[model samples]
Target chain A: MLFLIEDAINGILMGSIYGLTALGLTVIFGVLKVINFAHGSLLMVSMYAAYWTVALTGWHPYLALVIVAPAMFVFGYYLQDIVIKPIFKAEQDVREPITVIIVTTGVWYILDNLTLLLFGPQYRTLQDNPLRGRMLEIGQMLISVPKLWGFAAAVLTASGLYLFFQKTRLGRAVRATSLDRQAASLMGINQYKVYNIAFGIGTATAGIAAVTLVPFYNVFPTVGVLFDIKGFIIVVLGGLGSIGGALLGGIIIGLIESVGPQFMTATWTEAIVYGLFLLVLFVKPSGLFGVRYDW
Target chain B: MTRRHYNKMAAAIVLILAFGLPLVVRSATYLHILVLLYFYAYLTTSWNLVGGFAGVLPLGHAAFVGIGAYTSTILYLQYGISPWIGMLVGGVLASFVGVLIGLPTFKMRGAYFALATLAFAEGIRVMVENIDRLGPFVLNGPRGLQIPPLKLGLGNLVFASKEPYYYIILLMLLAVLALTWVIARSKLGYYLNAGGEEPDAAMALGVNVARSKLTAMAMSSFLTALAGAFYAQFTLYIHPKSVISLDLSFEIAFIALIGGRGSIAGPVLGALLLRPVSDFSRIYFGDTLPGLHLVIFGVVLILVMIFQPRGLQEPLTRAYNRLLDRLAPGQTKELGT
Candidate 1:
């Protein structure tokens, strides 16, 4: 029972960051209809930003979030407006929508390689931080203090985004655009602004997630590739455009990743994870909680 | 001269260049680049057979390529088979695996299909890296295979220098290009083109969409695997990480796309265009900025996406034809008249 509880807790902790990493990707996909393959790289860059800020100024990792989050948000906002906008403007045949996937792939290569050039191949870590070795125990359950922050960040941001969509005008407009771009535009929504903001907020989640996660995973150029692929699986599992689905999918994947090795050898970890991705894809392409792609 | 005469002249010039340039350019390094250029041309052109003509967007082709590489290498290392024979065995293996990947995936289209294929490719990477329990023979997994240096000869397909490789890869590329030409003019090309253009319509017309796609995948897989086998022999190493990497898949796809996929010469043009850029960048700026070449390539991709997302092949051919028209407007029509 104790081991089970411990595994579940660990799974949930890992799931939080995964969920957070996926939120932006889901949001961007929701409105832009472009699968931003570069999202993982965005998170990677943000983690590095947090790392460098702290490394240079001796600031706490969490304190670096304010600088990094907004920067990432802006970067995503402009990327959609500048590069992606023109592609959308091209004729369907002349500019294949699939080209956007290629374009994001290009962006991914640029960002990943640019970082490698700047940062070299070394993994950057948060050293001498108070989050290190800090843990909370609750009756045989041990949780790292920083990980608790990760869970909190995931929960808070999720709820925050939910409420934003529920209450705010911009959020509803964003949702409306996602539901149907033409219909929403007819209702007089500035389609581009909504897309830009959706993209920005979506990308900002990576920053928040990175801040929470840097304490656990080291900052590296290729780190985003891991999360990006994981985040992609989670997004697909949750449903293409569903935010809550991403969270649910992430937790489910986390649980599997955490407890799967107990039943099998470590070699099967990826097979297990990717197998689940295929399973979900085959069984419920719409995802567990997501509605069928009506639009 | 007529268009046929122009084509013959162009062919003659191209043939002379392909064979003669190596003789003139004695630098082994230059020949090495030319060899790699043709190799990529082979892989990407084969990839375009399925990706461009069939429009399946198979992002997992690296899986087939890697399978071919490892299959041939294992056959050579473990069973004492020559790579020449092993390449054929590898091609057959990749075709089988390609069908497996295509059977379920051909039902899907676009990004979903791309994702499934990517999953299979990544899955292969994971599977190969964990073969420790397979026994005493070191397939090397992630550490990669280091083949014992073989005797330099035609039978072994191992040469002491770059000259033979240049001719071999160039011949292989010409063979693939010929294959592409035949396909373009044949019934299979029409089936693939029809299936790509309108799957439902093709099925309605009795063009077996699934079969067409499966056929393309088989050919594509076989050709790509041959390239992989070639790479393993030339590099004298086989790492799943390098051979089957996602980066290589993306590179193949981009080369095809940027060169204008679906056309016979598109992948060839793509490989030729990017090879020099990559080599130049690596030579000049690679030391100062480890990834400057890819950065430039990335920028080029973005620019291509913006300007000519339709790709450069059509535009390039048009420009070439226009130049011919301007230089000798009467010559092209004079022969027929």
Candidate 2:
């Protein structure tokens, strides 16, 4: 019973991080209707940004988040405008999801290779501070302080986002555009501006997730690929465009990963998750929280 | 009738060139390159069936290849079975696994399908690395499985020189090419094309959308597995990292994309072009400028997607047709005027 409880706690913590990572992907998909395959690479880039800031300026890793997150936001806005917008604006039926996928995949390929070229594939750990070594003891089980902080940060960020989306005018405009771009445009919402804002916010979330995760996870070029897959799976499981679904899906997958290894080998954990994904997909083609669209 | 006659003549020329070229280029190195080209072309052609024709975009083909390689090598090492029989067993097992994966995930389109395939490949790689016990011949995990070159015989299919492997792979390539060509021209091909172009329209038109996609998946998996068997035999080694890595899957997909998808000749063209470039890069730049070739290749990929998404074959075909028009002016006029 104690073991199960510990697993559950770990799963929730892991799930919170997964949720945070997936928030940006889901948001982008919601507004732009494009799956950013490069989202993982962006996370990787942000993690490095945070890593370098801490190394050079002697700033606290958390403090570096303020800079890295906003920087990523601006970068993402421009990236979408330059690379993605042109593709979408092309004369052909270029807005097909497959075309978006190919474009993002190309971005992923370029960025991943760039990271390898720059960083040289060596795994770098954030410098050990008091926060790094500390752990919280509960009964016989120990929980790392970094993971605890990650969970708290995720909850706080998500709550802030929820409040902003509900209250702010820009958020409402973003939501309107997501629902119906043409209708939103008719109602005086600048679709391009909304896209820029949404892309910025989405990438910012990824940057924040990177900063939060860096304390525990080692930074590497390929590190994002694993997290990216997990994030995408969470987004799908939760239902596309459903933030709440993402949260729930992340927790479920986290628990599965945490407890699955106990029953079988850890190697089979991924297979188990994929197997479950297939099962869910077969049963609910629209995803756990996804609404069916005419398309 | 004239076109049919011309096609038959072209087919005859190709067959003669395929079988008889080995006699002229008896150099072991050239033959080795030919074998490699044939193997990759065959593999990529198989990949194009599902990824190109059906538009499923399986990013985990290397997993199927790994399955085929592991099955044959393990059987050969343990049960003392010849690879001739072992390869068949491997191909069947891989196809079965492919069916299992395809049945559930084929329901989803685009990114979801791609993600699922990637996850499957990673899962297999992890499993292969962690299997601790399998008797005296423990798969050396990350280091990979190494086997001795078997005696050359009809039953073994193992060769002392690259000459025999060249012919074997050539035949395999021709067979795969012929098979893909048939599929491309058949009703099933039409169904696949329709499903890929517009799934809802195809479904409305009485196409069994799911069945068509699954057929492509099964065929692709089978051919990939066969190629994997050949790869294992040729290299005399099979490692999880080498066979099941994401890099291998990416390479296969890259070849298909770079050559052109949805065309019978695309994979063959892609494999022939890119393999030599890669080999050349390895020889010249590997020591002094490691990873440079891959960096350039990545840049090329980006440029290709941005500029010519249809791949190198489209422009080449147009140019070739223009040249033909110029060379045979009277012939073109006879057909049109």
Which number leads on DockQ?
1
Among the numbered candidates, top lDDT falls to 1
* Candidate 2 ranges with C-alpha deviation above 4 Å: A1-4, A91-96, A138-141, A182-193, A261-264, A289-295, B1-34, B132-143, B287-291, B330-337
Residue-wise C-alpha lDDT for candidate 2, range B1-337, written one tens digit per residue: 3433554676699789888988899788778888898888998999999988897678899998998888788877777788878888888888888888888777777766777777788778877787755576567677777777656676776778888788788889989998998899899999999998888889999999889888888888988988888888888888888899887887888788778888888778888788888777877767655555555556666566666776778887777556556655545323310
lDDT of 1 by residue, B281-323 (tens): 8888878878777777788888887898757787888887777
DockQ values of all predictions? 0.55, 0.38
Candidate number achieving the greatest TM-score relative to the actual structure:
1
TM-score of 2: 0.90
lDDT of 1 by residue, A1-295 (tens): 7877788888888887799899999888877776788899999988998888887888887998889899988988998889887787773333126678888888988999999898887887888887876878988888778977988899898889889988999889998987777788899998778878988898899999998888767888889999988998898889888878888888988888787777887668878888888777666666677757632
Query: Clash pairs of candidate 2?
Result: none
* Predicted candidate 1, C-alpha RMSD: 2.8
Prediction 1 global C-alpha lDDT: 0.83
Taking all chains together, each candidate's TM-score versus the true structure is 0.94, 0.90
Q: For candidate 2, lDDT tens digit of each residue in A1-295?
A: 7887888888888888888888889888888777788888889888999889887888887898989999999988997887766666552343345655666766777777677767777899887744676678988987778878888877887787777777999889988987888789899998877888888888999899999888778998888888788887888788876777777788888888888877887767776777677666567756787756322
